[model samples]
Target: MELLNQFYANEKVKQTLVNFITDGRLPHAVLLEGEPGVGKNHFARLIAASSLCSGEKKPCGQCRNCRLVLQDTHPDVMLLSPDGADKPYSVHALRELILSCYVLPNDGDQKFYILRNVHEMSEQAQNTLLKIIEEPPPHVFFILTCQNHARILPTILSRVVTLTLWPCPVEICAQALKERNPDTDEEECLRLAKQSGGNIGRALSVLQDEHLSRIVKNAQEAAQLICDGKEFELLCLLNGYNRQKDDFLLFLGELRQIFVEALRQKYGASDKNFLPGAMLNRISALQTMRILDIIDKVSGEAAQNVSISLSGAHLCSALQQTLRG
Candidate 1:
């Protein structure tokens, strides 16, 4: 992402940013909602840099403020996210930020406070944010990023201008990857972009790393185990996930891909296996619908910052429900 430019998929977002910079029509808060790895953070950083840059258009990418922003030393810009657990934005962090908002800017005409992954914000933090959005200082601008916009209180949503970011187009993702790393192979870039479903960051991740083939292989194996009625193998897979908790999402994604593949296989197979045990009876069409439902429900639950164990239990139940059709 070229900060000064290169935003794709939503013109309103660019227009919103434009309004803030040129016309000084800045909102107290703006909610940027989008899918994972879709460059929401990059957009947030660009907006912050634009706010701090003293040039006519601000984020000239050639100005001193731009340099400072690139160096991650911009005084007027503050970035905060959830702590150690990689989840839960505590009320404590928000409280500190809200207090700091009153101090005003140091080196520029405005102040930018970015709170990423705010879906994890504590209830108290959300309330505090509601107050800030409702009655913020003139030069202050808040950008809150979350995978699900609904996780923010309705009151908070009402107070701010909302900009929803969509995933970058696959072609755009390929172009970006090529620009970012000229050494990258075109075929691999296109493949990753397609596989990533418009999330260029994730596309890059999938493309650059060769180690994930093992994860994909394991996922395929797990899917076969489910189809084969191998309960012990399923247990082992779950245990393996528990041991390496950091890749929990990746593991879940893999399982989901397997489910999707199973659904796709229904197109050709005369008698497809949708799920194990109780779920083995569902029709292919019903199985597909159920898979979508499960994905949606699980994803919705994740936005609430629920525990993986609880989520997995629910997910397993959902799978059982789908197959029993």
Candidate 2:
């Protein structure tokens, strides 16, 4: 259970899962829902390992089954995902997987299928999976991970046990980061933990990726510029991403997170400062809400293959107008 112990926060969910494993009452179909970096995939793997472990303590980590699962070489544990960049599970692939479910396990009495980001499956593909999930073979288990469960069909959802993962406290997350990267500076780890709002995966990404770190830094600067009503500076900053749609999307996501923190602070719901106290004083809750709306609209447009230059310009103009109002 080393992996489970390392999974930060969500004590209740972890206990429930431990109970299910101990009682041999683990469900046939499970859906893990959470935003990116919340550890849904890691949780899914934990369930898979726990179910397939041959050792006394479930998921002993050193057991043969546990080792195989950790290495992603388990014969009975299959990892499935969408076909391509568009990230849609094809009906043909779903059919093949469904057919394989009836086959006996390769190494153990039970088999597990870990489906990553199942929310990407199209309606047709989902319907094709419905029958198998509704009445899966006794030896087969389906573990699905998704950022949002709302995109899944209600019928499919009805057949599965849904578990949601959440961010841990900042101190816990920072400590985890420190443990994972002992050579890194403690102050840097805490800064990343705060920036990511206690999401370990996100903080780790920023710590490891210089480009991503730069994006976050730029987004913070943009937020400050918006609060200062420096339209020209903000526009110049945004125009730097005129040809980088992917980077622009990431920038918008980080920008949106700052506004969300701002909104939370305005309502006295959060004390973690994403912006300076002076900047927060300059913007009202209503203005933060409007900026969030603008970011959402621009983000959607940017995702739809809109020209990055135009989207950047729109974001700058809309943010300035909202702040002025």
Candidate 3:
């Protein structure tokens, strides 16, 4: 597939894979670990495509094999994911995958199995997988993708070639978004890229989420209310958000970003300051630090399944106390 070329970030990882594919020295088992939306799954597919492509250039996008892999209809490629609504791969499913691997390739000289969220596999399941990866058929290849590699067994780690994917620069991510959707404005792209914290998937998600603009406006309004020490108005404003847990978090996150942007502005480093200038001028460096501390504390508490209303109340009261001083 052309996905490797299109991968927005991690040039080192991309170059490493390109060398492996070009030299026909790709490992029998590969593990790709990265944050969510860092494109681990797409990178894995590109590796599989390179292995299965029939053209002189590995993964020539126009080749039949590349097309099959792109369309996810390749008989020789198996995608093993969480089955039976379980956190880990079932032992039965692991065994079936092992048995299936031994069968001859249906259409190519080699077969590829792409495992998603492989870290969720139980120790027993990984052990079963380890046995095959240790002594796999010459033509069989395995690609594993996960968010965390520490959870994987050491034995499994030792047997596989591991690669870490990092978030791309915002500029690269913005360029990618522009290429994919030419009509999106540069301002929106930069906003999403900045807010997403370099995650291409998240940047794209922000663009697609219709409620985001409303969320940002509400966050800015809420920030103003808190900073102005409007206690009753702040509570009432937060009341609108307290019913939905996700929306509450989203609101708080946007509010938190405004403080972050304020700190950036104080340092003369901010280009995308979303918070109003009047509010920004009111916040001193020390005040910004204090507010950030409050945000961190509230965020930690919220993670413990605290009620959204209580969290909102605490956040508003704390902001009042801090900003009023």
Best by lDDT: 2
Q: Model 2, stretches more than 4 Å misplaced?
A: 83-88, 265-273
Considering summed lDDT, which 10 consecutive residues are worst modelled in model 3?
80-89
* lDDT over C-alpha atoms for residue 235 of model 1: 54
Write down the TM-score for model 1. Answer: 0.74
Q: Rate the local accuracy (lDDT) of all candidates.
A: 0.69, 0.89, 0.80
lDDT of 1 by residue, 117-203 (tens): 888876677897787778888888898899998788888888877888876666777788888878988876766665555567676
Candidate 3 per-residue lDDT over residues 72-190, each given as its tens digit: 88898888677546433777777777888889999868999999998788888889889899999988999999889998999999999999997677777777778777999887777
User: Relative to the unseen true structure, what is the C-alpha lDDT of residue 39 in candidate 3, on a scale of 0 to 100?
Assistant: 88
TM-score per candidate, chains pooled: 0.74, 0.93, 0.75
The per-residue C-alpha lDDT of model 3 at residue 234 equals 79
Top TM-score hit: 2
The TM-score of candidate 2 is 0.93
lDDT of 3 at 281: 80
Q: Report the poorest 10 consecutive residues by lDDT, candidate 1.
A: 270-279
Tens digits of per-residue lDDT for model 2, 1-325: 7778878998988998999999999999999998899998778888999988888888788898888898888899988777555443788778888999999998879999899888888889899989899999999999998899999999999999999998777788889999999999899888888888888899999999999999999999999999999988998999999889999999999999988988987887775664578989999999989999999999999999899989988988898778776
> Model 3: which residue pairs collide?
none
